[model samples]
Target: MTVRSIVKFPNPLLRAVAQPVELFDDDLQALASDLIDTMRAAPGIGITAPHIGILKRLVVIQLPSAAKPAIYVNPSVVQASTEMIRHEEGSVSMPGVTDDIERHARIRVRYQDLDGNERFEDAEGLLAVCHQHEIDQLDGLFWTHRLTRLKRDRLIKRYGKLIRAS
Candidate 1:
């Protein structure tokens, strides 16, 4: 597996809706592995294919205490708890900025395993937040879209300054 370059915000591919994975082959497994490596290199807990300019519905997540990374292909939230919780959210594509985003406290997601077997899992807390955030990316909704207009504008401005500084 190779670490892929992450596409930054304002990239058209980041805004494009990702296509569902239809083949469960070595290539698919390789992409998942690459995503894991890329996410770890980003020092982030979660990442999506779109982050690397691949418009595929794939996500990789490894919580701080996780023993190994989790891969989700064509994941969708089948159910979500009404209880909302706020979590500080950011993205690998847009680094150095984050804001409180309200999301379901728990969720049931349907996705395919590496072998293309359909599976379901319930997630809560940070796991749920991570899944929701990554799913949004698959749907072409960046995490900042969850923020208020004022907050979103401020974050974009801050990110611009950071880019300029670099």
Candidate 2:
């Protein structure tokens, strides 16, 4: 597995809705592995294919305490609790920025395993937050979109300053 370059915000591909994965093959597995590697390198708990410029509906996630990363192919939220929770959210693509974003407290997700077997799982707390964030990426919505207009603008301005400084 190799660490892939993460595409930053304002990249056209990050805004493009990702296409579903069609073939579950070695290539797909390799991409998943690369995503895992890249996410780990970014020190992020989650990442999506589009974050690396691949417009495929794939996500890799691993909580801080997880033993290994979990790969989700064509993942979508099947159900979400009405109760909402606010969590500080950030993205591997748009590094060095975070803000409180409201999300479902719990969610049931339907996705395929690496072998293409369909699976369903209910997630809560931080796991739920991560899934929602990655699913948003697949849907062509950056996490920053969850923020208020004022917050989004401020975050973007801060990010621009960081970029210029670097």
Candidate 3:
């Protein structure tokens, strides 16, 4: 397992939909581990395979309070609560910026474990937002797309400033 470089914002792959993970084998496991390592190195609580330029539907989340990371393969939102919550969201690929984006307060996701066993999870609060954010990435929707045009443009300008300053 290795910590791969994040693909970065503006990478076309971030706008490309990821393919479902059909092979539940060692290679997939290794990729999972690598994702975990890369996420930890990025210091992000969640990351998707797409973040590292792998167009596979895989997500790794390690909530700060959780005992360990959770891996989901081909995760999709099955149901979402009517209640909405705006939470600060960011991405490892985008790196330096975040904005409050409204999302369902709760959600039920259907996905598979590394072994390909289908499972469902009911998540709320931060976990719910994280799932939606990552799943959107899988669907070729970058987090910024959730923002209003003005907000997204401002955010991108700020990002460019940060990049130039660095």
Candidate 4:
């Protein structure tokens, strides 16, 4: 496993939809481990395979309160709550900027485990937000898409400045 570099913002691949992970083998597991390593190195709580330029439907999330990271493959939101919550959200691809994006307060996601076992999970709070956010990434929807035009523009501008300064 390796700590793969994150694909930066505006990379066409970040906006490209990820294909479903058909094989649940050692290679997939290695990719998952690499994703975990990459996310931790990026110091992000969540990341998708697309973040590392691998267009596979895989995501890794390790919330501070969790004992370990959760890996989801081909995950999709099966259900969502009527209630909504506004949380500060960002992406490993777009560092140094975040915005309060409203998302469902609770969600039920259907996905596959490392062994290709189909499973479902009910998530709330930050967990729910992470699931939705990553799923959106799988569908080629970057986090900035949730922001208003003005906010998105400003955030992108700030991120551009950060990149230039670096």
TM-scores, one per candidate: 0.98, 0.98, 0.99, 0.99
CA deviation > 4 Å runs, candidate 1? none
Candidate 1 lDDT, tens digit per residue, 1-166? Answer: 8999999998888889999999999999999999999999997999999999999999999999999999999999999999999999998999998899999999999999989999999999999999999999999999998888999999999999999999
How much is the lDDT of residue 24 in candidate 3? 99
Q: Tell me how candidate 2 scores on lDDT.
A: 0.94
Task: List ranges where model 4 is wrong by over 4 Å.
Answer: none
**What lDDT is reached at residue 81 by model 3?**
98
> What does candidate 2 score on TM?
0.98
Q: Which digits, one per residue and each the tens of the lDDT, describe model 2 over residues 1-166? A: 8999999888888888999999999999999999999999997999999999999999999998899889999999999999999999998888898999999999999999988999998999999999999999999999888888999999999999998999
Candidate order (lDDT): 3, 4, 1, 2
In the predicted model 1, the residue pairs found to clash are: none
**Each prediction's whole-model lDDT (CA):** 0.94, 0.94, 0.96, 0.96
Candidate with more favorable, higher lDDT: 2 or 3: 3
Q: Select the stronger candidate by lDDT from 1 and 4.
A: 4
lDDT for position 111 in model 2:
99
Estimate, for each residue in 1-166, the C-alpha lDDT of model 4 and write its tens digit: 7999899999999999999999989999999999999999999999999999999999999999889999999999999999999999999999889999999999999999999999999999999999999999999999999999999999999999999999
Candidate 2, superposed: residue stretches over 4 Å from native: none
